[model samples]
Target: MTNTKRKWFIYSLVGIGIILISLLAYCIYLYQVINDSRTSEMDTTKTQLLEQTSYVDIHSIESFHGTNSYHVLEAMNEAGEDKLVFYPLEGEQRQLTVFDMEDMLSKNTLIETWQSSCGSCKLVNVTPALVEGEAYWEITYHDNENNYVMNYHSITDGSLQEQFKYPKMFY
Candidate 1:
């Protein structure tokens, strides 16, 4: 090939190589950005759920016998009677079924000597010592005798601390 023709060929190959490299780099950067965004979204969701958990009402069933037979479980809404078995404290809400309660209560500490209302109640093995100054504590219990178990943890350092699970017999 003549000098000019050879030069033209070489330049064409170099241009194609540069274009290919640019496209590859862009694709890699896009993948990283999407991955990072997804991770951040999940973290935000978790934080919101933790915050909602702090405000749901957790009370003793012993105190509720005369008030209302239909006790609304916390983290759950009044519609559909769905129990808040698990969810981000604020974003998504899920119900706890009868089987779910039974599973959770199976490991709970049964309050054998209680006389107020929950005669055969099962509570999580959580004590004041486990919660006093801590920021969170996971508690699980049977929502009712029907075998619905509700599991939840509390956020202790904020305005929502009053909703922390105290020993209760709502079952």
Candidate 2:
């Protein structure tokens, strides 16, 4: 091919390569934006639920028979509302009001404050009484026919410890 023709061909190939790279980068950027938007949306929705809700009733906390396993059940309730008539376990349980919920569900905190007797808990241990080092949470969300449930499972010293998950959707 002539020198002029070869130069034009080379320039054309370079231009096409640049265009392709730019398009690929834009697509990747768009995907990241959409993913981040979904995460932010979920966080906002969770905060709104926390604002409108009130309290949680921990129903059962039991150790698996002859095993280092345990389970806990809790129900979230609106403050100042009376729905059930179950016997008290310890002292009187207090309902969390809107204001209280706001404070507990603050952002940047991995664990909610109301999940424990004290507001302080390690991220590794789902239980407040125990402290963990390397173990972390393995979260699972299930939507069964009846209800939406979540579980935060952690393993420490070969024992499985679980924490109750709040309802995803409120009535």
Candidate 3:
């Protein structure tokens, strides 16, 4: 009877292990589905973007989510001038706006400002964003304490627009 009870306990543990593995697999599947959906939406936008814009070559496309969401495209025009195209996402109450890269404040200047403010922060990315019809450089970084920080600065004038700092939840 004792041997039988031991076998039952082992079986129960194996069953629990299987269940955990299955749950992990399902979670991974869900993450992939969400990521694919996001990329597919951008693919659809690029199709429409080519039709509505005159950019000769599209270098990169990045999605920015904030009070206003947009697909910011870095492209080159006919005269070989680099341009930043702000294509408003569907359901957004905004029109397409494009800017000559030269018209905007340089990324280097934005980084310089970020460094002056937080000398110990480690930068993640400097993304171009369009917010409420205004162009901004969205800076993502990790503070000295490893807190996630997002700083938005006006691309037109190189002034701080907004900032959010998210503290690290775990060591």
- Encode model 3's per-residue lDDT on 44-143: one tens digit a residue: 7777776666666788888887776788888887789998988778665557788999898888988998799889999999999876777789999999
lDDT of each: 0.38, 0.38, 0.86
Clashing pairs in 2: none
Kindly report which residue pairs in candidate 3 clash with one another.
none
Please report, as a residue range, the 10-residue window in candidate 2 with the lowest summed lDDT: 64-73
RMSD of each: 18.9, 16.3, 2.8
Instruction: List model 2 lDDT by residue over 1-171, tens digit each.
Output: 699999999999999999999999999999999989855644443443346445344333322211122121133465543221112122344232111222222222433422342233223333312123222234233333323333333322222365454454655
Worst 10 residues of 3 by lDDT: 87-96
User: Top model by lDDT, which number?
Assistant: 3
Query: What is the lDDT, from 0 to 100, of the residue 138 in candidate 1?
Result: 35
lDDT of 1 by residue, 40-122 (tens): 65455444544654433222111111111111123323333322232212223342211122223221232332213344546
Clashes of 1: 6
Could you tell me how far off, in angstroms, the CA of residue 76 lies in candidate 2 after the best superposition?
6.7
Candidates sorted on TM-score, descending: 3, 1, 2
> What TM-score goes with each of the models?
0.35, 0.33, 0.81
